[model samples]
Target: MPARDSIDRHIAYWRAEVPGLDPDVEGVVTRMQMLVRHLQRRRTEALGELGLLSWEYDILWQLRAAGPPYQVTPTALAIALDTHPATLTHRLDRLTRAGLVERARDRADRRSVVVVLTDQGHRAWESAIGSQADAEGLLLAPLSESERRTLVRLLRKVVLASEKDGTELMVVPRSVQRPEH
Candidate 1:
């Protein structure tokens, strides 16, 4: 059996102090939250070393996933990132100043603009992505290949079930879709 971690101790303390609590459920949820926080912090630190912020890395990644010519409308990018338009505009401003992204008039709709990744942006994004992958690997190093696969399957089950009512809002990016053999 796997050894108990901090969440195990936490659940024990909570269960003793509050008799009605379900330690199994509480431990799982708490551990999930703690794992997310840890991953986020690790990612932030990794990106920092490359002189990139999380949002910047995210935007570049989305554009990169969009494939060649690497551009998307500001509205589309904002939607994909789950961010407010004003907030995205601010990020775009910073990226533009950093020479990572450029805002250009959209050809199809002259009234609107498109965010395109510059060459420098691609280099920065690639660096950040490599760093992130290394960081994630380090985080998961304790898990064997089989364990990682099982964990991914289980997490997908939970996430998909949780998306029941919100399926319409989900965006299945092309990069994640399986290709034909």
Candidate 2:
């Protein structure tokens, strides 16, 4: 077995299988991993600026951008984020206590509840979003305008492909019911 860092695995694989492959693959992948780590750390810092956790920001952002009324069931958030039902409920409870969101019975179905953002929640979310965008922009500043556009298109294709049918596409104002065991 070759030592982990011995000739780069990416280079070895491509060189062995395909002829005249670009050498940038190893450099790109390694740089991407570094960028991802740095971005995740900056993301945590950015969200914390609004006194919110990563999960908290995700939920609020989902509701706000989810179109008019900006709300969706906990189940929907879970599915979109690939999280569990129990985990989503716990997060909802935390957000509710912070007054960032509220859970109310769905008018059409008494047994069902919807999580809605409050006024304070909206302001907090706006602050978080602005900071995040600024941070991400700075992170990508190294890339030229054309590079940025190309990167965005490539990344979006990968993201959309992975999530295509993983969750309901509808933007709903209601959530799945959670009854105590």
Candidate 3:
């Protein structure tokens, strides 16, 4: 038999409180939520060690991921990050002050502006991302390669179903394609 976890205890309490509760559904949802919370905490700690807040790392990461001469229009970045333009501007201001990014007039269109990633920004992004990857790897270390693959497949199915039932999933920007791993 598998070892019992906190989710198991949680489901037990809920089952007594509401007898109609489906243990299978409750268990799966609770476990996924708990896992996400755990991962978020780990990511927060990792980013903190690098002197980065989550949003700051996100902006730096998006800029670094834009291939060399790494830069992008503020509008495009706002769309990619799913943030409002005003909110993005505020973030940009903070990044700019930290010397992590700079706003430049686009040579192609004098009226347009672009956000360029500075060397310092790239280094910070790289270190933060490395820490994030290490944390994720440690989290999955208990699973075998095949198990990891299976888990991903199953999660993809769940995500697709959820998307189909409601709004479409946000499209990833073309410039932010996943690197070949």
Candidate 4:
């Protein structure tokens, strides 16, 4: 009914250059990759407008998700964020200066430290989350409700397959696992 998008053109080009090429496979993979990049760019722009880096917003959101008191140890945070402790420590410094977070010694363990989300930080995190959701919704607005549901289900199938394969093929390190209560 309408002209195809760039991925369609890519499939056509590949078909022309390499006979027997599987256009269906190539098209789906290419489209999925382009969609991911588009979503990432949208997220980056939304957070950047609020003066928050992606990593900063993610860390803040993680702390916020932890609920009441809104605090977690740096190690726990590092595991949740899938980042190095040193990198998170550096980010914590910037967050602290912005008054979004505060680091204090643990009362029960004098040698330990804990990170807490300040009220301002909670507000910023909420604002960022709202903006990010709006941006994502706008991106998906072109799709019908049924289309969205179908897309989500299909994507879940692919993701679950990949995750299962990954779990079978790899072993997670202890440091990356969630901390025990």
For lDDT, the strongest prediction is: 3
State how far residue 147 of model 4 sits from its true place (Å).
1.7
What's the candidate order when arranged by decreasing TM-score?
A: 3, 1, 4, 2
Show model 2 residue runs off by greater than 4 Å: 1-22, 153-181
TM-score preference between candidates 2 and 3, better one: 3
- Mark the regions of model 4 whose C-alpha exceeds 4 Å error after superposition: 107-110, 166-181
Backbone clashes in model 3, listed as residue pairs = none
RMSD (Cα, Å) for all candidates, in order, is 2.7, 8.5, 2.3, 4.1
Clashes in each model (backbone N, CA, C under 3 Å)? 0, 1, 0, 0
Q: Which residue pairs collide, candidate 4?
A: none
lDDT of 3 by residue, 1-181 (tens): 8999999999999999999999999998998899889989999999999889999988887888788889999999998888999999999999999999999998889999999999999989989989988988998999999999999999899889989967667565887777678
Cα-based lDDT for every prediction? 0.88, 0.79, 0.91, 0.86
TM-score for all models, in order of appearance: 0.85, 0.69, 0.89, 0.84
Q: List, residue by residue over 50-112, the lDDT tens digit for candidate 4.
A: 999999998897788777777888998988788999999999999999999999887779799
- Residue 74 lDDT, candidate 2, scale 0-100: 71
Q: For residue 92, give model 3's deviation from the true position in Å.
A: 1.3
- Model number with the top TM-score: 3
